[model samples]
Target chain A: MSQAVPSAQRTSLAVPTQVALAGVFAALIAVCSMLPPIPVGGFGVPITLQTFAVMLTGLILGARLGFLSVLLYLVVGLAGLPVFSGFNAGIGVLAGPSAGYLLAFPLAAGLAGALSTVVLRRGQAAAARGAGRMGFGWWALVWLCAMVASFVFIHPMGIAGMMLALDLDLATALGADMVFWPGDVVKNVLATAVAATVIRAFPALALRRF
Target chain B: MNLLDHRPGTSPVHRAPLGVKYAVLLVLTVVLVAWRQPVVVGAVLAGVFGLYLLARLPGEFLAPWRRGWPLLAFAGVARFASGVFGPVPLSPLDALGPALVVMAAVFGALAAARLLVITTPGTELLDGLAHFFGAFRRFGVNPEAAALAVNVMLRTIPWVGAAVRAHAEALASRGLRRGPVRLMGPVLVATVGHARATGEALAARGLPAAPEPKHPGPDYTRGA
Candidate 1:
């Protein structure tokens, strides 16, 4: 039942709708970020669902809008919205120990979205090649990409921010940041699984020209 | 859904222009960071309280901090614990100074930001943002798009929140106690489905399309 609509036939949304989608995702991110963090005893770096929402933004919205969605969230929070983790806000939140992770959000979403487009495109090509089994591989690739983005973008920046804001050396900073890895892995895996399930149920979603 | 704690008032702080309030908040936050002294942080915290009072916010406005104080206390204790196990053990008094400073600065910053949010309505905040970013229009930035996004997000927060709660309850009723994780799949499906429907609605309305580039550049960068 899948019709291959030409990219030309698919219309770009109205500016208002695009903005609305971005805003919706931004609010999603904020809600996720501000949810009462799972209290991990020391260092106060609570396990947060912000990363999960970030990955979902990329996987669902594509790159440009994904990036803008996150950028908008950050701008609003910095503009004195009580939307940051622990109900915090202001430019000072960016100056705090968690700044690295916070600042890396847009880049993380952009990377995840770009990687998702590539992976889904390849999956579609493979499916056309009569290799339906490759669908599982593509799903795995989506998860891998999310994990890699977190490691490459979120963790490193977070460690650096911790180092500067908390005044700890590299080793200590790394130690502090390591606490969130397990939770992050779980969150990203869930994000990947959810995205894969949604795309499978709505094949047209995978066919969109990002 | 009640994302902003803003209480309508005719107080001077509430009457001041959004830009001026933002400017004042920025200056105060800068000084707090730069000074990093207990006295400075304490003074700023006091100033924020004064502004809160000036805005005539109800006493309950600070109620959220009741749940927050324990965490702040834990933070101070964690610092002292870290100091004791450090390469060079710090005396309790020495550890206490830095801990208090960190706590005070954080508390002060949070108070100041809350005050801003508490006084400014969400719509006015979005308008201020649109105005603030208007200057960037010359650089190809779109302030209307940005404002629209923020506005949409403000509206969606409650919708998504309710969806999550509803999904969680559905899962729980089905004998799945571990609801949140299991709820993710359904929530994602529903949200993506809603987004697609929204797109279709926009298309059906015949919204104007963005102009195509004359050069017809390579499609390699389509997703980027």
Candidate 2:
């Protein structure tokens, strides 16, 4: 059953390929960040598609590239490309109220990628035990991992940033951040579905050390 | 597809070395953000305007601000309301002044950053950054790879934007009302596919594995 796995899945990518993938995903993240926000329920921070893009990058690109891609996006935005939410850019945006959330992007991507890799390895092991193609189960695990990563990394860092910038107590900051939960669930689900589809289409999509 | 804010020009701002311009921009932004006084903020705004003129930016360069008008209005209105109706009330006049000053500082900072973007081409800016980070190469960091990544990112941004628009339209035409959300899967698949193809192309070009060092100055370890 292990022999049934595609050769591409086991093969490692060249360094250039890894770098290019990271760059491309970084560009995608920037584009997503720059998209006009969809105002949700009058919260000052509008719902942007950036988180979804970050998660997708993580799941598809794997840990190292996922982290690099997001970090690159932040660097580009800070370098003044108007790539931040609402087309605002520069170091000030990073230093401003949303700084925590901004800073957490790379960490969120890293955690998501790491968790996905762990789940994927487990799925492969199961496949080696004569289990059928690790199809829906793999995707479900990916979704769960992405959600957990978001909960652990993105939200906490974001709330902390909000507290500092807004001068709100932890409870107040959490309350303000709570409005994003429902929307984030939808975004994470969408990202997982997209990533799963991409991986299924290209068995060698995820990054592996060369 | 026109993702870059830089416009082709021969103004002093364009001619100035990237480092000097960026250094000035950084210092100015720091000062603007640090000084909350109306006078300081106003002076910074005026100085930014002067630089804008010197940079020879077209009226269209300011077009990005139109998007912020509603936010600016909301900020003003919200500030006024809070001052008048809060537990410790204040005169509308007092509240309005602070709100306007805050708004002005924000606008000034944004304009200053935009000016930097508008005058600097992406490649030059990245090269400048790569040079700045080249100092870290001694610590086993590959600044060249980082620079290449940034270059690829800058070049690919417009392509990604176009892909999103094309994907969204394709979905809409297929009767998917929520095109953007529905767009996620297809776009990701397409983007990954494109990246793979790009990677293959770059490999095919036989680009050297190690980029040549920009400044191969004195090799002390090599008996220099």
Candidate 3:
């Protein structure tokens, strides 16, 4: 486990370990979706920490596991668990306004998770060079990765989903989706902070080599 | 186990093979999304409702709406607005009509999925999924692992909820609970640590994912 160990000595995650981690992380996400809404704005929009959980899963689990976990969560929901926001379930979600966002989540998690792995590996290298571990710079970079995934993947998919499902034009779809931008930004920020703490406590959680 | 409410019965719906039920649901979902005609979606919804009755699963007539209204309302308002305000505006009736049809599609799909769960036992689901995954053996995909992953996900959900509740209570007892963000970090850490422990236990058990992980023993594609 030491850095001095040769690359040949590196341990890859076995199939069972990978599957268990993915499943547990997926359940964590489902629970996050069911967590009580923050009661934001009093209008009953019903915001949950699910978005934060989504981003953090990516940042902490890296690409494959992160993608698998989110995909598992969706499959469970579509198979009839009320694990979606507002406790929605089933394949109908794919044809609804939330379809775009929900479908985009696995991709977004993969993109964010990939970026996080790169950031952590590079950060670990820097730490080995005496820069220390998961510093403020590392946190900011991780946060940037999550934000990039959110902005680049989730919004566009959501808008497209709305346009397709609701028969809306691009302008209208974008307008409707824009309402949640601020909240997404806050969630990404919180996700990075949480992920940073997680990696610090369990360095092997995201990357095996520290 | 109670999460799915799998009512026991010998009805045709219950006796139907899992794959057929799944295929029907999948087909209906795609058709429902593509066809916006209220007449068609309504027919499918009624058919699904009838299946519920036939199965003796008269579980709750209002159950679908209880879980479905929020999603319907959201989609309905958006579809209604889009129709009224689009570049080539729809007539009020046209707008209102398709919007309702789309709502039917959503509800129909949800009900179909619910029906699948109601008639099928959870173990059947796992076996079915494993059988489905068995097709990917050449790609290094372990069928049992996929099934086990889903099984673990089902078991882990409640534990996660309990962990979050415990975290909240502990924070409240110490008066350190501040905002939503505070408990999240600790909950994630605890859950992940638990995952690691579970992974270690699974790895130590090393049961080979069945009679084989890399190689197939018998063709147990006997699907549920």
TM-score for chain A in each prediction:
0.86, 0.87, 0.89
How many clashes show up per model? Answer: 1, 0, 0
lDDT of 2 by residue, A53-172 (tens): 998888887787789889888877877766787777765553244668889999899989988987876676676676655667777898898999889998999888755433335665
Q: Tens-digit lDDT track for model 2 on B1-224?
A: 25565687999988899878778878876776567688998998888888888877757445546855554454345445545555566798877776676567556766777788778887777777778668878886578677777777777888888988898788778887754446777787788787777778777875315756688877788763
Indicate the worst ten consecutive residues by lDDT in candidate 3 chain A. Answer: A1-10
Q: In every candidate, what fraction of the native interface contacts is reproduced? A: 0.43, 0.43, 0.56
Q: What residue runs in model 1 are displaced by over 4 Å at the alpha carbon?
A: A1-17, A34-46, A90-92, A207-210, B56-64, B70-89, B177-181, B202-224
What part of the reference interface contacts, as a 0 to 1 fraction, does candidate 1 reproduce?
0.43
TM per candidate comes to 0.83, 0.80, 0.89
Ranking by lDDT: 3, 2, 1
- DockQ, ranked from best to worst: 3, 2, 1
Question: Which portions of model 2 miss their true places by more than 4 Å?
Answer: A1-12, A38-46, A95-97, A127-130, A135-140, A160-176, A206-210, B7-12, B32-39, B56-64, B70-101, B165-182, B211-224
A209: Cα error in model 3, Å: 8.6
Query: How would you encode candidate 3's per-residue C-alpha lDDT over B112-215 as one tens digit per residue?
Result: 77788777887787677668777888886666777778888888999998998898898999999456668888888898888878788888887235534456
Highest DockQ: which candidate? 3
- Model 2: clashing residue pairs? none
Models sorted by TM-score, best on top: 3, 1, 2
For candidate 2, the TM-score of chain A alone versus the native chain A is 0.87
Collision count of model 1: 1
Candidate 2 chain B superposition, TM-score: 0.76
- Which candidate has the top score in lDDT? 3
